[model samples]
Target: MFNFLKKKELHEDGTFDESGVDAGDFVDQKPLDEKESEIYTDLSIHPEWHLPEEEVYVYRFLNQELPPLQPNQVSVYGVEIKEKDGGLIVDAFVRNSLSKGIQMKPAAIIILDKQGETVARQPFDLSAVGTIPGKSSRPWTFLFPPSSIRDSEKEIPAQGWRLALELKKKPTKHSLDLSDHWKESLPQEEAQRLHQLVDSMKPPKAGEVNFFGLDARQADNGDLHVTLLIRNGSEQGLTLRQLPLRFEDRSEEVVAEGGFKLKSLTVNMNTSKPWTFIFPAESLKKTGFGFVEMEGLSSTEVMEI
Candidate 1:
């Protein structure tokens, strides 16, 4: 059994320093051409292996160089893995690299096919974690083989399997804390008045949703009220289904669950609506954030305030 564990620590300033054996060093920098695909048999177990369990090969590729940065500075990028159709999907993102003092979010995607079936996927998101530092560009890659696929007993086709990579760039803003710098930026009276208004705001009514922008405010009672704007494009009514809301602490243990409801106004088809929900403040304080998931949704978007 070849068990490998990799870990990286982030500094208080939100930068990540890479320290490892250069596991990705062996991968050729040349793009993956068709000839490379021919080197490995499709869906067949490699004959040289002696281990009882399947093998997963991690490969890293340097795709491109990023713009120059100030001396001795570092940024962090992160990779996330999700399972899809018995395969793994990967996403990557870059953080703290923006010159404007904000973070830039970039994504990279990869897919793998085994035995003619799409068996693995990878999506990378840089925003999920810290970024690497200096003038060097950080390029990363990993592989999930058949042995790692949960249910491999059933044979899948070879032609159906394939691998791919896609990259995209988008704008992202990091949330700012009023106590951290907002007070200094705004007059005391205006700041206090804004704080009072937020403190007095009520929870979203049932069936009413608000799309208040990013940045979440903490109430004195230790509750978090997140407002989201919901836009309806169709002529028919949309029912908001229930999903789980989970809260975890700094240690990543679940501290609270439930207590928030999705409230939205009845939108006539082709109209837009806003909604909001309030969860226990202790939950956010413990975990930093809470998550809401509903069925038939492609993604979850959270605005800080």
Candidate 2:
């Protein structure tokens, strides 16, 4: 048995893949190691990512002494904007948190005011920024031509301005390992939203199953009505073989013990299901016990089953 209901950052950097697209827009985001092989695109450094001019810009920027970064954050800071030759020039430092080098490919440079209103938003081809080595900071410049100025009514913000990135959205990655039957009923956007929601959930450690007792109460006949949650955080699904549960009350005293045979019950990977267990009066321990201190069942342990 494991923690029942228990168990419990992608930053602005526009992620890149061999396809030269930003992976940031995808709903299902996972660490490099956990994704399915075919669907996963390694967004790390590529030899061809840096053009001759782009390489020079990154080299010069990283050479400058920079400040420390929080453990895992891709920060775009040190924004300084200027209007030159009837065009806007944005200068800022792009910081990378990954140990692997990243060559930013494409994204929008959005300027916002003090109240968080968009002053100017322009998409720029960031190939010029080139490859930003991991664990380093690089300065890149973007020039929004005069044409971009007319696109928005707000004038260029000088004093209380903030610079941000609007990474382009990529097409849906249906290659994800979700069941086709489940996706059939879901609209495209809704399906993508669910994928994002599920993917954002923090799964139990690899090969660990958490059993949580959501709620429990004593029936009039002294039987125990227990609502339990079974969580399977592993990459593979399994049908519960058996459950040997021992429920303890608020006083930490055993209140019930019953072995439940889950009839062909199945839990998919990275998902959980709820079930109600009724412990007959005979199976319950001494009464007068308060709330329960739910315990684990070895059979439900992610490692064993």
Name the top lDDT candidate. 2
Candidate 1: TM-score? 0.22
TM-score of each: 0.22, 0.35
lDDT of 1 by residue, 42-96 (tens): 1111234343432323212211212222322222232334445655433322212
RMSD of each: 19.4, 20.6
Q: Which 10-residue span in candidate 1 carries the lowest summed lDDT? A: 36-45
Model 2 poorest 10 in a row by lDDT: 1-10
- Highest TM-score among the candidates is held by which one? 2
Identify the runs in model 2 with alpha carbons over 4 angstroms from their true place.
1-72, 150-155, 168-305
The lDDT per prediction is 0.34, 0.55
lDDT of 1: 0.34
Q: Can you write out model 2's per-residue Cα lDDT over 221-244, one digit (the tens) per residue?
A: 888888665667665776877878
